[model samples]
Target: MLNTNNVDCCARVRHGPSVAGLQQALGNGAMSNSISDIENSKCLLVLATTAPTPIPSSPAG
Candidate 1:
């Protein structure tokens, strides 16, 4: 009974408008550097939905 002909499995996937707009304003849409480049970065910017938490210590202690 499933109607799959018109469905888009990846419909929920998307990129922010800033990313697309910048790619249009500039000539390229791909990153200039790779993940390895992060190793040499002097500063880093991290974005997350929640604050990081530490793991609980062992109960045997």
Candidate 2:
């Protein structure tokens, strides 16, 4: 359920109250053009600068 509200909060927290991050994220190719575009998209790809796993995490735990 990612939306503007969540993105705003995340951007503010992560980037320190800068809307630039939010705008960049919204304009990113990974982001959907519109709600309809998101609904129609079947495949999702996420690439992060940070790793996906946490310290005590497991592949099959």
Top of the candidates by lDDT = 1
lDDT of 1 at 60: 25
lDDT of each: 0.57, 0.50
Residues 1-61 of candidate 1: C-alpha lDDT, one tens digit per residue: 1865555432134334646766887766656677878888899897863346643332224
Deviation of model 1 at 50, angstroms: 6.8
What is the TM-score (0 to 1) of candidate 2? Answer: 0.32
What is the C-alpha lDDT profile of model 2 across 1-61, one tens digit per residue?
3654532233324454335655676754233367887679898676664656443322233
Off by over 4 Å in 1: 1-12, 16-19, 47-61
Q: What is the TM-score of each candidate against the true structure?
A: 0.37, 0.32
State residue 35's C-alpha deviation in candidate 2, in Å. 2.2
